[model samples]
Target: MDEQIITNELLKRYLQGKCTVAEQQLIADFLDDPNNLILLHQIMAEQTNSLWDSSADVPQHDRGQITVWQRRLHERMEEEQLIPSDKTKPNLRKRGIIPIRQRIQWYAAAILLFVGLGALLWLWIPQGAKPSEQLVHQKNRITPGSDRAILKLADGSTISLSDAAKGSIADQGGVKVQKTAEGEIVYAAVDKRASTQSYNSINTPNGGQYRVTLPDGSRAWLNAASSLTYPVEFEKKERRVKMTGEVYFEIAKITNENKERVPFFVETDKQVIQVLGTTFNVNAYADEPYDCTTLLEGSVRLVAAHSGKSELLKPGQQALVGNNMLLSEADIQQNLAWINGYFIFRREDLGGILRKIARWYDVTVECPPELSTMKFTGKVSRSQSLSAVTEMIASINKVKLEIKERRIIVKK
Candidate 1:
């Protein structure tokens, strides 16, 4: 097992959303107990006194109020005789003003000051069991997806990018393809003099994701059940990539021999998007009703594949092409939530939400027709187990879920 040492600085970085995913996981692992209140208090002490001044940046309150609660908790710990006796004293380390056990008592007392449940907590604290904590200990829970994908080189050979050892994996047409410790494939073109460019494809299965840096320095993030095919070198007049399913791109700016910016084009089933230097997300799944493109930064032009109709999109705008082409203002964050490790449903139908879950969990869902149209609006962390997420939704919507092997049955 790896040793994890949490520091006040790391906690501060976590509070500021500046920590990496692994760092966030480390902090979460350490914070699973009230005994770890010492670390929590250390974090709080490093911040401003007022709650409003904390990392959340919400409403403000008087600093004296917290001091009053702290004092009240200290007094209650003494009255309840919950503090360990001197003879039975454990080798405890003090982080703040009180011993570790006494600090827990202070926290329980403070809860009483706000929640008015002093007696209930006083009885429960000695047992050291919390309802929320117990619920999390359930043994049956699906694990979230991690680094998993397949890389198809121009030579008709494939490599499992997720399992491949980090370092140079292959060389395609003078371009060095290397897998990094971060589970990303990077292309370093060694010889630009190659007369022809070789194409490579990367595909992600259900419950998988991968990132790639193209030869042009543009970065792409592939979501579950998606594939991207690109050339090993951008020797063409315009850099182009063909993709299926869903992907997010940060296109790089490149200039041609004419001294004009070369346009990057993304071809999907429903439409073609052209941009010079911008960030955007494209959802072109075969199972979905429409192929959608959402622009995040800069601008993009979307041309409908069937009708050849064109629509120019600004940041925070979306273009959807199906039997017809339509444009509307979009929620940029919601579109990019999957890549950022979350599912933000905004009044979406239950069936639509379940489709996303099925893809991520790699399970089949069977729901009654009546429940298909049920609407939901909430954000759930993608890292949560599928059962936990479904249970949460079931509780809120007054529904039940039956699990049979890998299948999920949704019922009223």
Candidate 2:
């Protein structure tokens, strides 16, 4: 392996116990080389110096701990026949080496020592010197989004869900709207006489997300910069809702007085989806070329709003509605990643991926027309800071992403 592959981030991940078994083995192999050991020592010294100035008072115990670990590592190297013993100074060039399996065992022991030292170094560094903090400081920090939205009642009043107290927030035509302790908005019908025509809407701004439980016990999760409008109470015959941007739904089957299942309907600009009881995700952002409806459970029928073209979607199937309706098997996990708190991309174009990042981080992106079509595949936690995410993207694509204030400039 290239010695350059052993980066500070990789070492930090190894020390944090976040590396895969293959990564751990790679690290072990890198450390087994004597020249790489010297390089690692230099890296440690440089990092330590950069983290602590001359006037900084590092604890005496920390200094002693580092010394002890270094001595132990030296002793281990001598025992493994990797270095000449002090008593054999005259025969340094003629030392015998161990067998391959035993050498691997020695490397494993050495890895433990290095891991211990790495842990100590990590703990000794100030908070500002940590990997995440370093990224934040290098580039201005932009925090991840949180659960926040606006609830619009039928009376034209808006309530900020982020600031509302954890209790009843509004009462709309005998329907009680509540803000739960878990940061979700729920609606319950308290009176049978309540008019089903009364409507309510929830709007999530950029860098925000929210979940709402409808009157029929169904749930909807709204992603960043999305909106969902539904009646305060469903009519006896059916439940219907209109939405924009992206939303995930877990529809509940309801039966009327006749004991027949009432169908649920979702209306987007490009398509309308009808389901009996199913889980699905709808991506209807106006900026994208197509509106995608991915079904996870049960069945759904998607009909294009303009052309009247229709298609039935089964579990793990997706219908992409645009100039024409196309149905195919879908990457269910990738489609539902937002609800699961991740940005999972599978050979997705750079423009598509950056659009998601811009929405979640509330930043604008400027990508050249040529680079916009470049494809990348990676998964990153949605909870990470914007710098960490952009850094990962830049590294994966061998490109550069520069952040200026609230905008990102992509360059090759």
Candidate 1 residue-wise lDDT at 99: 39
TM per candidate comes to 0.67, 0.69
Name the best candidate (by TM-score): 2
- Write the residue-wise lDDT of candidate 2 on 182-246 in tens digits: 98998887887678788899999999999999999999999999999999988888899999999
lDDT of 1 at 1: 19
Q: Which stretches of candidate 2 lie over 4 Å from their true place?
A: 1-139
In order, what is each prediction's RMSD in angstroms?
Answer: 14.2, 13.3
Q: What would you estimate as the lDDT of candidate 2?
A: 0.73
Residue pairs in candidate 2 whose N, alpha carbon or C atoms collide under 3 angstroms? none
lDDT of 1 by residue, 1-412 (tens): 1111222222233234453332233233333334434333433343324343445433223345545544554454556554446585334354223432333332222222222111001111113211221112235667777778999988899999978999999986678999888878999979765435578999999888889999889999999889999988876588889999899999988888788989999999888899989999999999899998999898999889889999899999998899889999998768888987888776677888888888888788998888777666655678877765675455332356766666778866
